[model samples]
Target: MNFVLKTILEEVRIRVFWILICFSFTWFTCYWFSEEFIFLLAKPFLTLPYLDSSFICTQLTEALSTYVTTSLISCFYFLFPFLSYQIWCFLMPSCYEEQRKKYNKLFYLSGFCFFLFFFVTFIWIVPNVWHFLYKLSTTSTNLLIIKLQPKIFDYIMLTVRILFISSICSQVPVLVICLLESKGVKTFIKNRRFFIVFSLFTAALFTPPDIWCQIVVCLPIYLIIELTIFYALIIQVYKRQLAL
Candidate 1:
């Protein structure tokens, strides 16, 4: 028992040390190319009429804060898979063989879906969202020149928030599968209206205050939920076939 405890402690310490190293590497790497990343994130706004392609920092330290925040997020993004793997390693020793197999697949799948959704949101959805917001900002009284220069902190935070929301939301399917039994999943699938309402509410909670953003984000979330149901059904079928 003492040996087991010692082993666990050693593993935890090693994983923590590696995590710190990876974070340091990622932080410096992101800082090195901060300008390019900032430009890429703000690229969508370039096409907008009343907005400059640059972000403004109202406070002297806001730029530093934004840069550090961006670097930290980038570090987290790189570290998530390693962290998840370490967590899985720590937990898997207690799991049965079948459970371990299922969990391992689910872990990788969750990671894949997370990054996939984040990239899609960051690359495709964000640009369109910015375009819509910029257009909406110019709706009434086009005579006045209203420049839309978002603060650096606000812009970076918004970008990070959207990415984080999308990544976590994408893991919904895997989490549902892992936490619930097949019967529970079937029941969840049957409640379409409830899920739709839940999705909208969740989107509203995560997205900007605008109704349009909520609606737009809600659609994909609902779709992912439905796909999760199908995924659950498929897993059930696969399991039954294996039993035979």
Candidate 2:
């Protein structure tokens, strides 16, 4: 009886120790994630000359908390696919093996492409866009803007929103594949003119109202659309051959 009780107590201690260890690691990771990556990311916005400093919150903690929260979300950004994979693993036994295999790459590529696309948007696209909008919009009449002061929370929120949206938009190929694969949306190969119009419309909708903004956004999408059509056509041909 004494031996059994001692064994049980040891087991509980081991389990608790491991749980605490795992939790400590994750907590430390969240801290480093917020501090290193997020703080660096916020550097550009923090140094921005135009961002008015007048929009001050009475609570000092408000700004710090906002920055921390923004960073925390960003830290978790890369975890989406990991979480998805975990879910996939959980559901794998219940799913048809072949079907699971087929969609596995789709699930993985989505998170990766999001990073790539958003990165492009942020590094190349957004800077140019910010410059253009800042320069062009403030012309003469509606200009002389007395340093527009934005709240720290609002700024962080806005940045996250735009970045996330653009990141998702970067997954145009994945979306195209889904439409072609699942839904019966026919590939728009024949109508180059219609493709042009449709592409422009989408760009205009997503981008700011400026013509330059419209053009810049549309051109890349248009290219992606073309590439998608090419690959889609190849797949269709392959499928048809298989059918015959």
Candidate 3:
């Protein structure tokens, strides 16, 4: 028992040390281009009717704070794959061949899906939603003079929120695949109604308290679930053919 406990402790310590080193290295490397990343995040706001190309910093430390936070986010973004690989390596020794393949597939699928939705959110959803909100805010107020002067910090945080939520949502297909493999596809089919309800609840938790936003987040997840089911069926058919 003592030997097992010591091994676990040593494994944890190594992981922590390497994680910190990876994060530190990534942070510095990402900090170099953090400004350019921030500029891209802020681009949607620039084209708004009353908003200018420039952003405003109200507090003396706001710029510093934004830069540090943005740099940290970018560092983690780049470090995610490495972190996942480290975790896989640590856990792989205990897994059987089948489990290892499943997890390996999961690793690649997660990275691909995450970045896929990240770009989709940034390139399409964020800008379109911002445009809609701009029109809604301006029209609803019925004001003769209206202006949108979003703070730099608030905008950055908003961008982070959208990116984080989209990345999480993008993992639905992976989650579905894992469930199909472990619990069997029939289980998901049987509980389809429950999953639909759960998806809505999930969308509510992730998105702002607005119906449209919830729908926007939930629709892609539902589509991914459908696609995963189709893929699973195809795989099962192929397996049966191989057996015969």
lDDT of each: 0.78, 0.64, 0.84
**Which should have the higher TM-score, number 2 or number 3?**
3
Q: Give each model a TM-score.
A: 0.81, 0.60, 0.86
Q: Give the alpha carbon lDDT tens digit for every residue of 1-244 in model 2.
A: 9997897677657655655565456545766666465554444454545644234555869867875676567645655555565556555666787878767877767777877887776676555544554455344565465344446566556566557657646677787777667754463454457768877887777655779767866787778867887898888889899999
Model 2 earns a TM-score of 0.60
lDDT of 3 by residue, 34-61 (tens): 8887887888777666634467889999
Off by over 4 Å in 1: 47-51, 139-142, 180-183, 189-201, 210-212, 234-244
In model 1, the worst 10-residue window by lDDT is 44-53
- Segments in model 3 whose C-alpha atoms lie over 4 Å from true places: 28-33, 47-51, 137-143
Error of 1 at 40 (Å): 2.7
Candidates 1 and 2 compared: the better one by TM-score is 1
* lDDT, residue 62, candidate 3: 96
lDDT of 1 at 55: 66
Instruction: List where candidate 2 sits over 4 angstroms from the true fold.
Output: 1-38, 44-61, 136-145, 148-151, 184-230, 238-244
Instruction: Write one digit per residue (lDDT tens) for candidate 1, span 1-244.
Output: 9998999899889988987887788879988877677776666666555525666778999887877777777767877887787788789998999989988888888888888898889778888777776676553666786667778788778877788788868887786676456457667766678878988888888888998878877888888878877877788889999999
